[model samples]
Target: MIQTRVFPGWRVVAGAFVCMLTGYAVAYSFAAFFGPLEAEFGAQRGETSLVFSIAAFLYFLLGLPAGLVGDRVGPRPVVTGGLLIVALGLVIAAHASTLWQVYLGYSLGVGLGVGFSYVPSVTAVQHWFVRRRGTASGLAVAGIGVGTLIGAPLANALIARIGWRDTYLVLAALTVLGAGVAGLLIRRGPHFYGLEPDGEAAAAGKASPSSSGFTLAQAVRTGPFWAVYTAALLMSFGLFTPFVHLVPYVRDIGLGSGFGVLLITLLGVGSTVGRFLFASITPWLGRRLSFALMLIGAGVMLVVWSLSTSATALVFFALLFGAFYGGFVAIAPSLAADYFGGRALGAVIGALYSGVAFGALLGSPAAGYAYDFFGSYAGAILAGALLCFIAFTIMVLAPEPARWLTRRARSP
Candidate 1:
């Protein structure tokens, strides 16, 4: 009788999941803190929104270096170190005496920390599974949804009871404890253990090839790379506006603060469902089409959001938008892997994400400023919808990678 060992790659996926959940929970929790921080510092809406924007920009931008470093050094040290930085950032923000100090601590500290942690952790999972790549990637990033689901309301409740300053202290402690333990579960790819991807056994004295895909330089030269990058850039311009502004938008319309938080929570619920739901269908729908649909769906939902005024309409918009947004996040890494292959995948994914960094840097803050100028979020919301449609058009026009096309042709 032959005995089969449990695949160890799932453990890596679990670790990545926890890391994403912890990091993004802290990141998205910025919404819950927004009003309090404004009150504390006497800052305007645009200024307060900048804090989230700067942090989002840094983390995504930093993903490039972090991914490069992870490619060379492996993920464990990089992820663990990043989490520590997150804890430190939270701690610094807890004791901040001024708005700039919050920026220094939260924006830079959290940004750098999440940047170091997110890409490495996510990219590590790509090297472990081929057959279930979509599922694994979705499961891994679903943490973002779960974190958002929990983070906003938790922060709101905590702030109500313990106040905002001490809430940061509490969040700092949780980051160190939760993400730290999960990071320990991360290891190198299956090749490092004398095995093949998807838990297949290697022949005696042979390990899976780790150098099977495009090098970073080669990947950058390809048309598919630029297409994906440009599409991601356009999609992101409106992608994160809701995360930073949705709560305030609800409140501005006379819905209570609690209702605003509830909308965010519902968004999270929709996001988690979308990740799992879309990933489950990708093998049948094809990555390109599935991803394009996510963009279009999100665009349509944003249009609905822009028009929403009543609580019921807003609630309906939140769930669907979250679904599409979550699907976009879940599918992106796998799509990159399909296009570029796994060689230097961390760096490849990171470079692709740089598009998102620039868009996010401008998007959320611009939305806030638009609101300030117009005294309504309608213009910014509609603009976000337009960007999403443009992104979808780009994706639809972009050709599939030759390698991916060949693979599909060869398949039954």
Candidate 2:
């Protein structure tokens, strides 16, 4: 159980928000430094993109172990350690002269920190709010958007004024304060605080045999796991492709940099709203149904994106499509927790996100190659639409976590 008992429930929520904002927010802002890194390091687009991919891969790759550690040792050390590593990575990146060094600092150091902080935050917060699980998780992950909102522009401004190297130093110090300090505060089970998880001020929490959820081994073997994995893979496949191309795509189509940046920001806002709002609405809609519907909606938007050109159309595309994609990020993990237990929640979500890392590996380069091969993004967008449809079909077939709970409840 979480140890500190001085604060109320909302305080926990606020802490979760701050931890997330610090952990994810600072790392995300690095994109604005991309041009500087490329100019200074003489890296190609593909190579620079891999820095993101590698960091992402490690971020998810370390998830399971972090989850196991969180379960056994409690989330506090994991989170605190993660924040420090992330902070160090930024500092290291600031001084690095080579592209490989940048990869080391960002992907290995900072990426590892993300696992320590991100998964534990989600799982721990899950312990705090059950009936309101959707909203709680929504709020927690919403920091990604909030972070993106604040981080993106700040990073851009910092890079322009202070140099990317100095910007990293400043951001690192901030992360140390925000994520590092907040993570040190995380407690394991809510019971230690004299309040049950989802009890009293929280309200209506239950633990069934089904609540044992899936062990990591069981999660690997289940059809439901694969179904969820496929859905996530497809969502991520479609998600990152556009991000990789957005700025260039707009410029290629003759939209000004100002407009291009606005469209990208719109996407972030759309996604943030989608994460919070769609997640809040998930219980009424049901998880699988909600995910499936979002998949279809995102697929439709992909088609729209392929045809869009004008500034207004691009902004609208980013707004709507971003919402669908962001909404998926918000809800997917809680869905995992509902199906699997909170015991290995970090690892399971980590593994799932690892698959998303693979999707990013596929999405960005594949989109680039496709454009080169076919001489158009048209083929690539069409391909993503087909994949999203397939993911939708899989979600339709997958059983709900509620059914799993009921089955366990009825058993001896």
Candidate 3:
């Protein structure tokens, strides 16, 4: 009888994908919930938006500690704990009677919860695969795009049928069910199962080389680290601004509510395609070049988006921009792994990803404030394009860490 073997790493990838998809779907559904929250609370755009910014800030900011915890204790516990906390946060938000309650329950709770799980999932995928790390990471993170694709329309439909509160309850249930299953399946690298990463026969011989690289302390001091960190921060500014504001902007520009939700879906579809497309070509173009080109593409698309006034123009912009944006996201984890070693990837990636926190803090509310002050999204959109261009420039010019370059030079 012939036996067929299933690689455990693929299971890890599947788990990460489910966790990311469900977590982001529930988290980003805030866009669909935005109008309802405002109507119920009688708050302005900027004020109501504080909840999401605070949540995202906590999510990205706390990812460092969460990653550290995952590094020390393992991913299973971290993901499980996060899933539970997210569920509780949603339940609390559903029952909240005051804006402060919403902030406390949803923003802080969900923020910390998601922070715990996000990096661990990404890091796990990196640990599981080497040659195909970009593809695996891209597949896992593509969940974010898929979540947005399904989540936006689902939330809108739920809001129309049942109330926003009930919609959140449904989301909470789904998040728990989906992520809990993932938590059970996710684990560290092949070492835990007494196998090698990628399950290759020669992986044992090359293991030491793969694990060699800067520790967290040493990595932080490198120029490449700062360059990537700053570029990620800048990228986040443009990336998240649209996630928070696009639906509202579409509405403001006279697209009906239904079309607004569909636009979000369109962006999701574009992003999904981009993530897969970019990741697939990373081996050919190299992560650095792939990321730089995608960043530039996104920046150009954002500029085009700003000129959009009609639904047709906006649709074109969404698909193009979303594809580029997704490509950028798909590359980040693999890029970090390339620049730094995979040994301390959890900590390094977490710290690098904190740029998302800072950028989200600035971008979302800034767009809201721009609208309130200027009565349009033009200025905010233009500013995001500029930031994306700046990020593209930084990524293109930055060299690999000197230590990494030296290591590569010394390698036979």
Best by lDDT: 1
Error of 3 at 115 (Å): 0.9
**What are the root-mean-square deviations of the candidates from the true structure over C-alphas?**
2.8, 3.2, 2.5
Per residue, candidate 2 scores C-alpha lDDT tens digits across 1-412 of 3345444444556666777778766656655655677688886666666666666666766777777787677777777788889899988988898999988887677678886777776677776666777887777777777776677677777777998889989989998898655765566666555565555532346553213567788788877778888787876777766655666577678885445555666777887899877886787889778888888878889989899988888888988887887788778877887787765676787777777767766776677667666667777777788788888899988888889778867999
**lDDT of model 1 at position 204:** 74
Per-prediction TM-score to the true structure, in the order listed: 0.96, 0.89, 0.95
Weakest lDDT window of 10 consecutive positions for candidate 1: 203-212
lDDT of every predicted structure (CA atoms)? 0.88, 0.74, 0.82
* Model 3 segments more than 4 A misplaced: 1-4, 202-210, 400-404, 407-412
Clashes of each: 0, 3, 0
In model 3, which range of ten residues has the least summed lDDT?
201-210
lDDT of 1 by residue, 153-242 (tens): 999999999999999999999999866777787888887777778888777765354557888898899777888888888888888888
Alpha carbon lDDT of residue 126, candidate 1?
A: 91
- Model 3 local distance difference test score: 0.82
Ranking by lDDT: 1, 3, 2
What would you estimate as the lDDT of candidate 2? 0.74
